[model samples]
Target: MHLSEMTPEVDTHTHTVLSGHAWSTLTENCLAAKRRGMKGLCLTEHAPAIEGGAPSFIPHSQQMLPDTVEGIRVYRGIEANILDHENHLDVPPEYLRLCEWAIASIHSHMFPEKAKKTENTETYLAMLRDPYIDILGHADDPSVPCDFEALAEEASRQGKLLELNNNSTTAHRPGSLPSLKEYILCCKRRRQRVCVASDAHFHAMVGNVRPLMTLLEELDFPPELIVNLTQEGFEGYLRERITRLKNLH
Candidate 1:
């Protein structure tokens, strides 16, 4: 089926006002996702490590939200900052355990110093080693360069997903398409999981991943690799992850 005629069942990455920079409310985002025909929405606020990002209490209080919002399943998560090569995350392990899913990304503002490609790659490798990290968000952004091939292979081995962020590839992040295309190719080649995200800051942009969908279609990328296409697959990942966390206790 052509993606132009389809929308992802779940948008695994997004932000609300709690992120300190985004424009929407969690309720508004959920409404928009439902209106756009999405079965699920992951509200992944930026972790505290980010400059002016979410407060530590935000992730800790995720359970206060209803399981379903505006008739759509709500998955609460965090876009955690990868602090350094040591794999330090902005959120503590206790808070990380509270999240249903987690997407780790390197925000330059969070780092004390500039990191080279080798350091960036090593940091991500370390982050993926943490089982709480379920997806890698916007590795396509050139500002935080890393070895996509290495990341894709590691994500595959760890059963983590690499995101194809719509905002990063389209307008917000410039000069990212070439690298994003390469990352997608690497994921396709390694048979790794991929999540298409709008990374929407506003309510209207939720579930708006048409650009990445078109690109995936152009590449003839297999649908099976795209986890957002099926609601069962998307939500199943969270359920399985939560279960794994419980088992670990």
Candidate 2:
């Protein structure tokens, strides 16, 4: 399905007021997404990685977020932090099990230097092999020096989705364009599918994949390869991925 036909895009990664650093409420974000014509959105709160992280403040309050909002489906998700060289999650597996979907990513605390980048990449690759991890968030962000080609190939082999994050381009980690380009090229070469994430910290940013979406188009990316273009397509892809991961474990 074409993205415009899908309309108001399905954003799989977003942050709400519950995240201390974020500025908008969940309802506000839902309303904004509606205005932007998004079919659905996921509220992926931060999963605490280190001693201090945004997720540490909210705790596991999935029950606090309604199942639906303003006629749009809102999924409860968590961007779990990779806290160790082993690529272990900071949030307990029990808490993680409660989420409809989970995005695992490396943060500064876990990836400190260049050598750590290689280690973190291997660790993330291992997590991608995990049945429960639905998406691998922002693999190209410069803050973590993973080899994009290797990561993309691994994701493709495992059938895990990679993210082209808008926020990674804007703030969370700046000056990431080159690395992002490399990652995109690698995905194209491997025929790997990708998901675009807003990584929004406020309501206004909820459905804004324009910047990265444009980049994808510029690179001549085939829209059919993006798993989230349609609800059924995404679910099927995710289920198959989960099964694949489960077999690995």
Candidate 3:
């Protein structure tokens, strides 16, 4: 499907100035989401592990934001830092429990040592099995390498969504191209679900995942496996997540 014809129902990973390093305010971010025809948007500020990430109070107070902003569903979440190979996250479990969803990532800036493929694979597997994390962010970033096939298999088994970040091409993360293609191909083989996100640091970039979507089309990736392609599909994804969370609690 064409990008214009199939805009993702939710731009699942977005950020605001509360993240400190990002430029846009939360209102600006929400306005951009509404203008882009997105049915939902998530303000997933970077958790405190990063130098300029949000303070602890941010996630705890996110309940104050309305459930919907400018007619778009808004979710308060965090891009939590993966502190080690054993799936430890920067945000505490109680703090994580306050958000609607969470995306766990391995940031080389936080842990500069390059991990072996086995170590990286284990990290992804452990994070996938965690109860709080709903999505895995930018596993394609080359600086933090992993065994894509192994991660994809585990992600599939755990019902977690692996991200195809648009900013991986336009922004930092230069060495992402080869691994991105490989991981998507791996997901295709395993029939795993994936989410296309802008990983937007600014308001204008929200819902701007056209490049990733175009790549998906070129690969002839199965549309049914992409959860955010349509509103109903995304709501169904949310319903499934809710069920899982309820069972966890």
Candidate 4:
């Protein structure tokens, strides 16, 4: 249950050209995941976040894709923007219903008001409570601050995973190291589940979670708490996720 000499079997968060700001195609992303020995990756396109992000119809339309591509299991998914403090998502209900998996994230642009730290905490807690959302992407972002302890407690209660975004470990999210460490520590202390994601915007970066893994290794984070560390672990989580979606109203 350690990070050394081990890698997550699935890259839970990734972007394709369809996300508007990313540089890779779905095919390229899949190949990269396969090369990295990933059993699969979630093809999560952004919606209503970037200026030219994927259309609202994109999520439901993803059903056209095969379950597996390039020998890698492809989970049709969307990274929906959390538009406001009311817990509203940019992707509408109809499209949301078709998403095989979904990530709800707060981008800087999504909440220009940048509500108070307490409000952001509430917003995140609301997201974690959502049955449709499998994970909350990059809550460590300094821009949208949340109380890490509160997040850890709520995520544990909800039985959902919190994202450890590798993108934040790099210069992409400046000054994020402290917050990311706090997030890891809180989750570890609470014995909460998590998923490490590359958050790759390019083909070559798929499954590129080494930096975050290094951080986890340094913290001695528990591997059993990470849902994607092994194929069986991830697949088991997926089955639970699919069942959760089906049982939702």
**Model 1: residue 143 alpha-carbon error in angstroms:** 1.6
lDDT by residue (96-166, candidate 3, tens digit) is: 77777789988887775546677877888898888788888998888887888888888888888898898
Model 1 CA lDDT for position 191 = 85
Compared to the true structure, candidate 1 yields what TM-score?
A: 0.94
What is candidate 4's lDDT per residue for 67-130, written digit by digit as tens?
A: 8889999988888888888899888766766876789998886578675789889998998888
Residue clash pairs of candidate 1: none
Model 1: how far residue 168 lies from native, Å: 2.2
Ranking 2 against 4 by lDDT, winner: 4
What tens-digit string does per-residue lDDT give for candidate 2 at 68-141? 79866787788887767766687676666666788987766455653566786788788877667877888787
The ten-residue window of minimal lDDT in model 4 covers 54-63
Candidate 1: Cα lDDT at 90? 80
What would the TM-scores of all predictions be? Answer: 0.94, 0.87, 0.94, 0.95
Q: Report backbone clashes per prediction.
A: 0, 2, 0, 0
- Please provide, for model 1 over 1-249, each residue's C-alpha lDDT reduced to its tens digit, 9 standing for 90 to 100: 797567998988889998899999999999998888889889898878776776564564788889999998988788888777777788888888888889988776566554488888878877777878888888877778889888987887877788899976666887888988888888888888889999998999899988888888888788888888889888767776787678778
C-alpha lDDT score of every prediction, in listed order? 0.83, 0.74, 0.82, 0.85
Residue 30 lDDT in candidate 4: 88
